[model samples]
Target: MKKYLQIVDRHKASLGTRFVNNFIDTIILLIINFILSFISAVIYNVTFIHFFYFYNNGGFLWNVFMGSVFGFVYFFFWENFTDGRTPGKYITGTKVISTDGKKPTTRQIVSRSLYRLIPFEAFTFFGTDGWHDSMTDTRVINYKNYESERQLKDEINSIGVKETA
Candidate 1:
């Protein structure tokens, strides 16, 4: 596990991968919001006429605020259930892990999600460590590489020690 953590820390996702992750996640979140709005409209029997109006006439600040709240919910639930891989991260073959090389706790997920609300948080990805990652002591790693390496290591260690699973 320690060695796997080392691999994850060293194999942090690149800026391009991170960008793709962000783009994919944003689109997913938007879709989720739309679905929820549709459901609410159906419940009201409004047929979403007001929904379109809200999107078209909503204030910029109101949109931003709701987006942030939505983002928090989106990130928290996905990371928690998927063990740190959001839909975007899963598609990119990446995952969020603690800096110490363990699964993140609920607190860490909450902190990371909230930190994402920071203004221009995406810009922080330009640096080696993203703001949400650095603040929460987490990293987004290339899980494909990490998982393969971990499996290889386990195989080697089991040689002559135990029966292969």
Candidate 2:
């Protein structure tokens, strides 16, 4: 239907926009990680006697596990608490929503975050949607479209008109 197509077009974010959002988010996360690592190094140097044994005995597996945990927590908490908008989404004027154009449930948000762990998931955006979105039945939509939809509904209601869509 015309309405359905229009809604889909309005809600879908362009691939360029998605790429930019991801780039910005990655940069921000990297900066934060760098600062934390610097602080840890300074602390370790000051308390060398206490942490020398643990610090020298490094585990690659532990590092990977902690990285995954950090990524999960960062994405999950931001999207869940911010109405599906992370810092990157906020800056890019995009937000995650259910396929039906509503806020996604907590489970959907968590699934979307976890799906990011998929190897080469970034390439999945070359298709219709990213793996995270496709798997979770969610979409990252333009906030402008969402605001316009809300205004339209409000106007219709004020005039006592029922919208079919």
> What TM-score fits each model?
0.80, 0.80
Compare the candidates by lDDT and give the number of the best one. Answer: 1
lDDT of each: 0.84, 0.79
| Residue 120 lDDT in candidate 2 | 92
lDDT per residue (tens digit) for residues 1-165 in model 2: 111324644678899999988998778777776676666677778877545434334477755665667778888998999998889999989998887767789999889889988769999999988999878878888989877986897787789666587
**Scored by Cα lDDT, where does model 2 land?**
0.79
lDDT of 1 at 70: 92
Compose the digit string of candidate 1's lDDT tens values, residues 40-143. Answer: 65655656466555654578886888788999998999998889998889899999998777899999999999999989888887777888998888899998
Error of 2 at 92 (Å): 1.1
- Candidate 1 lDDT (Cα, whole model)? 0.84
Residue 99, candidate 1: C-alpha displacement in angstroms: 1.5
Q: For model 2, give the 10-residue run with minimal summed lDDT.
A: 1-10
Poorest 10 consecutive residues of model 1 by lDDT? Answer: 1-10
